[model samples]
Target chain A: MALSFKPIKPLLHTGTNASSRWFSYIGLGIGVLLLLCSVQMFINIQQLLKEGSIRKDGFDFVSITKNITNETMGQPEKNLFHADEIDAVKKQPFIAGVSPLLANDFRVQLSAGNVLPFSTDMFLEALDNDFIDTLPPNFTWKEGDQHIPIILSSDFFEIYNIFAPGQGLPQLSKETAMGIPVQISCYGSNNTVTFSGRIVAFSDRVNSVLVPKNFLQWANKAFGNKERQDASRLFLKLKDVNDPQLVRYLDAQHYVINRDKTLLGRNKIVLQGIFSGLGIFGLLVVILALMLFSFYLQLVIARSRQNLELLLTLGYSPQWLGKNVSKQFVPVYIFIVLAALLCTQIMQWAFHHFVMFDRPELSSLVNWMVVLLAAALVLMAVVTNARLVKKLLHGLG
Target chain B: MKLEIKNLLPTYFEEERKSTSEIWGKERSFSNGDLVNIVAPSGTGKTSLVHFLYKMRESYTGSISYDGKPLKQFSREAIAALRKDQVSIILQDMRLFEAQTILENLEIKRQLSPYHPQERIIEMARQLGVDHRLNALAQNCSYGEQQRAVIIRALLQPFDVLLMDEPFSHLDNANAKKATALILEEAARRKALVIFAELEKADHFPATHLYHL
Candidate 1:
């Protein structure tokens, strides 16, 4: 006797006033989105800061200098490097390559005809070709080329702008400065050599004005006094910048790091603390939303006590009824989570477009890590609400 | 299937009343297809007896077993399964969902057991004289119509036992006769035992066994 009957529709008693708690759903959505954004922002910022601080390729190089100490107090000659100390630093396991700064013991003067008041004596330090971030294909120079390529510190532009306005001098942009050629005259003990110096690039890591190693070697042979060029500083390439052993060893050896290459450890710590605090606050909001949802469910069950008991008498298991009732809210959960994910993606786009505007390395779409985080949050909400519904049904029993 | 009851005493009963009562100590057993009419006056715990047997009220001191398993040992799911597949009850208040139509009330039970076809449910309603009102909401129906609808609902399930708590309290003699004939016909077809609690058995009522609680 197969019954020709329709499926059992959910009774009025099993339904809920979920629409009345629309604010809770919106609250949870915002909370979850904020949580995801904070975590993603923290990840992106950390990656940006880490990439800015340390490089693992050939670019991961830092310049190290021995501090001016009491032992070398007015002895300018002793301020130069000793070969044994350089060899000891090179022998360390972390150092990939160590090159000494080739400082020509000569006087160099720069003149820009009527653009400068007088010829200014400038200090020149040259490094290896591998240290240049973007070495142009034609960066090399010959002995008679009379044209020297120079790299200036990025900070030099900022300092120039600060003083030039007060000094009534025109400020030079990077492009403007690149085209300007100035006269350079070098003086040693017996001879004087003249060349034209052209600005090539600005350096964020290598702080000093840089020149070609070949030009320095040639100039040293022709005009330098010392037979062996003693370096005052050394460039070191390490595998990892955040390695604790390297920092400890540098501190022990009384070495000074380049001022521009400071890592963002304390800044990252403060940022993580703030973002984690925001994450905790968002979690609290989600928890409060869940509590309100549970209360709403409880009220529905309470008001329908008699109808539920009647259902129980009709051979309906409370678990089955509870599941049916609990499943009614699954769509709400999906809608809120999808809404939150959509908003999070929008926020991520805004973040990459505006906040991380200039940093191409930090700009990215949503990471897989954030998707997992959102999935975890949805699972937490569903499982928690299901358990609450089951507990309430159990209480009815 | 058989139900056995021995030395049952409900905690809701007063201590002095328990001392003066004999029904609390009496033992009884009912087999399949046995029609037992429990005759008791008002405040005699007839509804309590039905509630206890249905496993709704647990504050009792006794052993009630279905087939050799004690009722106290059944888990909630097991109890619900027994209620779903083995027994049907027409509660005293005719617990048809007031917010639903008469056909919807019957469908609630009919969906649980697919063997009861819609035609048969409608046929039962026709025999009970409530077929014309089946589309109306239960709350809007007259008391007798609602009572017949509950009777039809209880019969829609395939039960080895049917429990009725004063099922015909609101029905007139003619309607009670028609409702009883339909219940007995369905019970006979399924070989289901019938238990009904009433204030008194009518002269025209045909009962196989009568017990004064």
Candidate 2:
């Protein structure tokens, strides 16, 4: 009787094509899941750092110190400080800028027909019109010789759309951006500007609505400093880059608190502990899964019935057959691990949608996780392989 | 091992359909180039003698040795080394790797064997009358083809002895003659011994060297 061998494929080194496809799917699913987690982790790290820097120096290279009185749910009214006393610190040379901001907690009835109840502590920067890169509130427009346009932050864009379908724009027509101005009834005077004002760019920091300095001053003066102080706080920026001298000058002020630096360190430790705990759990699950699903060498040896028979008759000892079979499966496992990692990295990139965490520390985490997964895969493959051999060769009389 | 079965004795417990039976046996040193034919009409322990010599059936009271050293005294690695270096077996059932080609099957054998000339395979192919199908997969080859390939593989080994069990069941008369000639030639070339279990007439092999059980 004729013995027919398996057919050859266009690709060399073929075996159990169905099994290979199953592994491919496993690798694909793993890759996509890992990618999702990786991107989220990366972006989370970036967010952490960005928030840290803002908390430290504040956006616009400025910090606010205000004396305020507000009603709190307390037995006795809490002692409140005055803004005029806070403005007195403007004489401090390190304090390069001072714009006392008077803001009140209020619910906003958005034009898109949604009510935003003020929840989180929201702060706004009272800016001068000439601050470069400052965008207008709630919109965007292209730049030109003289006209400065407004741009909306990503958060507002996702939440609101008018005239444009998706409402995302680096470039929008003059008509759409400049056709209708948003009316502000803040100081009860109900000031209105040309709804056709130009929009330039969006604020990269908090999802805050940006308006011109005139608009901010007008709103605040009409509403009164409410806190009853001449100035909210003195904002400061260093006169020169890497000027530690300015840092020293600021440090000399006893009121200077390293709140930013301290919080970053504390949060980093806390977050690290949490992620490490979760990562350990994940690693355990992966190990258990691999152990159960291992491509056992005994199975390979058992399946290699014809091969062993031929090798034995070919003057090879039972021992020799055992070793040769072990050698053969090495390449297969290596191929699987490598293919898995490659597909994983690709899926991660796809899931990220090209938005990677540019911060240094989080990127390092990405690198570490990739290496970690690769190592784990290899270890799992080898351990299961060796155990299977010992079992298969048991009682080889 | 000069395993002299001095005053050899054994015991067995055999449970039958409704009763049980036991038997005793004797053994001697398996000689070199002894075309050993172990025969018995029924259960007379013919195949058992070979099995005990190889220590494959170990529920016995006979001693096995290699170059005067006790088989049990050696480490597993040492025994494996001895098996590879000193003895080769053409197993009862023909077993081969399905993944390898016929040539690759032989090549694996040649690789495991000590240095042979580069043309050793071609020479063996020509002698076995399988030179035309060197690249065919061993699995794809017919039983006769696989049998010849296996015999050639055994011949390629630089070992002291060969164990055979009905190894020529698949060959035709002409091919069988060629294979027998090649075996005898390779045995003399390597100064090696061969033990074959014959299921046919012993008259085909040299009369002087044949031993019947």
Question: Which regions in candidate 1 have their CA more than 4 angstroms from the true location?
Answer: A1-20, A54-259, A354-364, B14-22
Scoring model 2 with DockQ, what do you get?
A: 0.10
Which digits, one per residue and each the tens of the lDDT, describe model 1 over residues B26-77? 6888988799988888998888889888888888887788997889999888
What lDDT score goes with residue A394 in model 1?
A: 78
Give the deviation of candidate 1 from the true structure as CA RMSD.
Answer: 9.6
Task: List the per-model TM-score of the A chain.
Answer: 0.52, 0.34
The clash number for model 2 is 27
Interface C-alpha RMSD after superposing true interface residues, each candidate, one decimal = 3.7, 10.9
| Candidate 2 per-residue lDDT over residues B1-213, each given as its tens digit | 233332233335232311221123334465455444443233444345445544445565646665667655756556556555666666545666655687776666666654465488778888888888789987788898888888877766676666666667788888888887887777667656666666554445552344443
Alpha-carbon lDDT, every model: 0.78, 0.49
Residue A161 miss distance in model 2 (angstroms): 47
Q: Report the poorest 10 consecutive residues by lDDT, candidate 2 chain B.
A: B15-24
The alpha-carbon interface RMSD of model 1 comes to 3.7
Supply candidate 2's per-residue lDDT for B11. 38
The local distance difference test score of model 1 is 0.78
Candidate 1 docking band: acceptable
